[model samples]
Target chain A: MNGIGAAMRDAAEGVDVRAGFTGDVLRGGRRRQVRRRNGIALALAAVVGVLGFGAGMAMRDVPPVSDERLLAATKGDLADDREVLLTATVAWRAELTPSWTRDRGVTELRGEPHVYWASTTPVGDAAVVMQEGKVREQWRTLVGLVARDPADGFPKVVGTTNPEDPTAGTESFQFGPGDRTFLVVDPGIPVYASPNATRNPAGVVRRTWHEVPVVDGVGVWTAPDGVAPSTVRLVTSIGPPISDIPAERLLTTRPASAYLRSGVHAKRNGAPAYDTRMWNNTSRKQLRVGPDGPAPSPDSDLFQALEDAHMTDIGPPGNTGTWCVYGTSGTGGGLLVGEYADGDEPSTLFALLFRADGTLDRVQRGPAVDFGSPLPVRVRLPDGQGWVVASSQYLGIAYRTSDPGDWQEAQTGSQAALLPDAAVQVRVGSGTGEVVVDLPR
Target chain B: MAVHAAEEDFEEFVVLRSQSLLRTAFLLCGGDRGAAEDLLQEVLERMFVRWRRIKGPPEPYARAALANASANRWRRRSRKPEADWELAGTPSVCGHEEQVVDQDAVLRALAELPPKMRAVLVLRYFDDLTELQTAAALGCGVGTVKSQTSRGLARMRELVVEVTR
Candidate 1:
């Protein structure tokens, strides 16, 4: 095999030798003119630096202002500690459920507001709910039912599809932040305040004002201690608040300055904006502030797909900056995969590989997924091609594939689609298949 | 002021990097060497104009310029016809090996790759770029570079099997 590889390399080397022949012809004409011009430019730069230094000495400098005077001029009356509801843009919003820790008599139930973004698009009003640190379970927004059938090795929390009565059985479901996480809230009844009190349809979600007086579609809440208001941050495609949020307590978090400068695109509805690659700038402080890592182990196939495509970045030029890598093992067809970059850890973005005949074959991930053990959450591409899941906690790979009803688990120990034989099947047909569309993943 | 470099040095750079550039051009053109060469030359010429902007080792900048140009060209060509008849005259392998079989099959396989996947393979395996280097060339996150590379490699494997078999 090595000999065969070397032969291929040798064959390729021959092509290089051949290209060398014509390359000289292409360069012969352009070289002379460039040399003469460069010779003159270097001399000019030296003279300009000498002149500029002389000119600088002739300028006057003003004295710096004193700190005391600056403080005196900017003094105000009182400190404002008002808590405002942080309405994360669609990009950073997630339904977080607190973990249930058993104790003596009183069960300390903490509802965490999981706020990681997903590359996968929701079908018929689906919302991903986070419970355990790495467990990204999908919840139908209205009824809060897991979408995956229990028979499948991994059952996902899917949204309801009842158009007529989306909220038929969800009247008693509490809609406040945290199932054990900290969220900012006012000390009031987390009651339903929609114009119509009637139960919403299965998939429809009607916002209920947890706090009474609604000021600008937001209300103050003294969140559960675990779900602190300060921890309740929002993620934007543009990243951090360019300006301050309307509330005083909610200071706009700054993402890695390098990330902002690097120019990752902020995606809206999974579409890249005009001059950006993928929107993934999260503040390092925010990522560090959270007790858990990324809630949903994003689909590994998506990551693998991206990696195989040469979309993964190695560390900075000389390891001078942070380097994050993610990967995936298998995939289904329906995914809206792109790229994202928070200043902290790097996310592994993945996309599916299509056969020459347009059939979905595999998914790719960069080095990101290998960093964690395995993730419990699995992803179903928008096309319903296959399913990919991962979990560092699992003894082996933690995902299953197939249509909604019947899914098969991936082999243990293999968490990435490193070879050709590792392709997983995504059964797309009548039942759950019709719901998934063949969109870009 | 206009910029220039010694003829010898310029030739050296071109000789050293031309094959890599050609491979990238190949992928960008859906495996058309002639079109890729044309694209590579256009970039090299532009680099000649602003060679001063490339202060450090010129290879990275040249690669960036070529990648950018290739991507732009791919986007532009996609809007036009499938391929130009003139482009058909371009050669696939520079060598004339009587033993080489299924040359057309290789071309067909190259054409089958997705635009992004094809670009990565061209930059990585064909152009001999490291993962990070490819990512920088593509202006995407490292994660994206990994995913795209995996996808490209997988597709290439399957296509190779299909074509060779």
Candidate 2:
């Protein structure tokens, strides 16, 4: 045994146990069984009553569910049935979560839920059912549907729970096998799908967000078979694409192709501005590959400092011990790097400027997720490389930095950028007006 | 018939793994037998309820639940004063007297770490869980398990020094 193992073994030695402990455990098992059975029985009874209510008034004409109500519903429909809507309401108010919300118990819902909208897509006869329930204290208005296969009469549940963030009025959820998905957004939230969103010469992944109208916050459209939710965006229907929060919350802002070719969104304090996804998908939709520094090769020493720092687990999975080099260093000899880290020690964003010899030439740890501070952190990289700017808030879009120019999207997710050197500092425009990520001299 | 069969299997699993789990639980609670017993019994009882639904090996599930519950239940009140890891430095356990001293120091030091950090170390070292396995047991990512292990060992050594000093 190695030192820790042997030491642990010795430390864990000589524990005493009572003879009747096993028997006590067995008894506890019976109590648990009763609790579980009672809980299930109660749940079943409530669901059965709701089902009966939906079926009983199957013929009653009902008005449309409020646009707000749709955001908190559990299932969706292609066509709205008034009875179904009422039944869903009863269940939501009573907090009786049906099988729709519990596992993929779509087949277990007694019958099809309130059909709000129905469509014949390549996927099949997709009926968006508005299944509403208060699951586990959160109002999970799932954007789900019952798709009756044309070949078989069986109905399958598609989509998932509503956004956990109550303020997140729009979210994409996949319930179909693979990545086939549906979306739930606030009513009239303009949505789009880029069958093929491509990056333009400007170095931003531009998507012609073809507007797909959302009725009561649910939109389902036809694609070949498997449509990736990443291709979806909720933006303005007009000419200029607007900064859409729902699009930002698409669980993806834009495709990963948006590389900031100019400045590093760096902070001397190691604050990271590494969000490639959010920066690309918005109306401000593009970041120019600025005229500065040598273009980063994949073999660049951006992560040399990360290696020096021994950050074994680099990023959210696929992001470790690799070069995600963003911008060119203005000094030309040095490579500026930004890496994200979160630990019990310190949740920080690192701005590492690696020397030609792969030493951490200059490093600053950025401030971590600050709920009170809403401004996006953008600061000049060492030696006047492109500035590094990123918003680390999880929910809201930091569209406008402190400076009121083109808004820098506040992103809770991760991004990596290398910017062009045309600008002195990134004028971050957010609701709070222009907040400058100070150029640390 | 199936219910009783499952019940029998559950009882057997508890009987076989109780002592080992209790030891893990003991270490997780920073060597508090009373707390370890309570944590194990609670976890096993939950296991007894969830035994049938738990696929494959039930030991992993029990261990996972124990680890998760141990981590979750770790609150500010239960925390020990921070160990001065830098001051403690690396422990050199070579001579018999030194080895005995190190061993005793290690136990005391282990008790002072945050419960989640200590649990990671215990699961990694004592239970011989791989990094991935430890992550699964703790309901965390493998990266977390790795970092926790590195930090835990470094902290443990520091505390070991502190104890011996």
Candidate 3:
């Protein structure tokens, strides 16, 4: 009669044990054992077939195809210029079963083969539905470098054209080093460009405009050479313009008072749009992000990172998002913040700062408060830095920056304008409060 | 004839021990009666397949199989323990009100523990197995059993405090 043992014994009492359960167990066990045996027999049969075929192959005449030739033939037109980045084939079947309500429960069932062809190009990717080796539906579009699938080893395309009517189009694709190239295809679609105000030092382009092609279905434009990718503020618009006038002008022409506002317009697709919504919501609510002290859970991502570094029991109890912040001194670290839970109860908000070597620098805890729909908080720290703080009622904030070493907390109740240099884009009111930043080019 | 003899022996073992085994299964499943029954059935079936070779007492083998099966089910389903225990419903806190409440808290805490840790506690306490016996049953060393018990009890104590608060 000890602590946990006694409690466990008391808890184990009063469980009802049913009769005749043994027969059920015996039946189920025999079924599983039989299935396993059958599976092994099938595998052995397959091995025998392979071995027999290998021995008989020398007596027969069969043409051998080299891997190079097979790959070359598969890569029809783009074989010479672009390497085979990745190829994926999808096979499907559509079945229809006709059932009658009057006489028969089911009458007939039919199925047809469905296949699709997709390839990722060096410039852009194309996906087309093929029927008898003919492209039935094709959509080719320019994708942003950020949207690329890391597994594909090539940049993935962003928007897709109406597949039923395969349109040939040319749009801008940003390659390395702010190199802008207009991708021209056979069938073209409308393209619009929004100039970046931060990068355009002269502030030359105040408005977004539709670029009329020099030639039909073809357009070429380069970033006024030497603009860095970070400084370049161009986003290609493949779909119809959101407004009658271009979006860039709409964003730039807004009053400074409105620019100082914290919230953005909620879009039709639930995305936060800067120009569409009036910045009306400004209620500064504080949420508990982590425990009062350092108590990292073994299951949390921060703990896993610490464990990977062979440093245990160093941080908070809950996993919060972190991003690398770089400084001019080439020194940087990660800023992590979130709510800490002890078992099912979340008690406090915590912000942990880690040094360049993945060691703890400083930790701060805020009072626990019930969080409402997370509104984007744009804070300007005391040292003239800006950050867009987004909170996940469960996971905490997604704070990311390029140079984090010099970051310092702003005075309580600081306005948004004083910390203007750092612009972290976040979608507010979204349950997760996701951070929207460009992928590093 | 041998198959018949083995089947008879397994049936007799079940008739004699199923009640006690079911109680252990019930605790292993965090008071989930349906899950306990299913777990018991699976363990029995596994035992049935190898019953002829099972010499001496079958209780240890049965207990080990029950622990391992519960662990495997948790792994395969990846179901949250909190939700599972909630579905099991709160036990009636009528007769020995305070003791019953404490036991309920202990059950909930046990449910939240990792599978291996939970199994160690179940075998060591609910089944009244010695540390050495628990180690042999779980196929681990005595040190592992010791550490698991320590960690499991500490987490349970923390969870009890949290629930009470």
DockQ leader? 3
- The window of 10 residues in a row where model 1 chain A has the poorest summed lDDT is A76-85
lDDT of each: 0.36, 0.50, 0.44
lDDT of 2 by residue, A120-238 (tens): 44454554545443445533445443443233343434333333433223344332333334443434445555443443332223445455556544565433355443343344344
Docking class of 1: incorrect
DockQ of each: 0.04, 0.21, 0.24
Cα RMSD over interface residues, candidate 2: 8.8
Model 3, A90-134: lDDT tens digits are 111000101110111212111111112233334344322211111
Superior candidate under DockQ, 1 versus 2: 2
Question: In what order do the candidates fall by DockQ, top score first?
Answer: 3, 2, 1
Query: What is the C-alpha lDDT profile of model 1 across A1-441, one tens digit per residue?
Result: 112223233333333434354444444334433344444534544565667754123223322322122112111111110010012111111211111111011122122222121111121111222222211222222212221222332222322112123222121111122211111112123321221111132111122223223222122223345432222232211222322222222212111121122311211111112322222221210111111222222333443343333332221111111212223323412222333332223433444444434345544432332232223123333343343333222322322232343343334343221212223432122343221212113
Give the poorly placed runs of model 3, Cα more than 4 Å off: A1-3, A37-441, B92-94
What is the descending lDDT order? 2, 3, 1
**lDDT (Cα, tens digit) per residue for candidate 2, span B1-40:** 2454667688888888898888888767666566678889
Instruction: Give candidate 2 misplaced runs (Cα > 4 Å).
Output: A50-441, B76-104
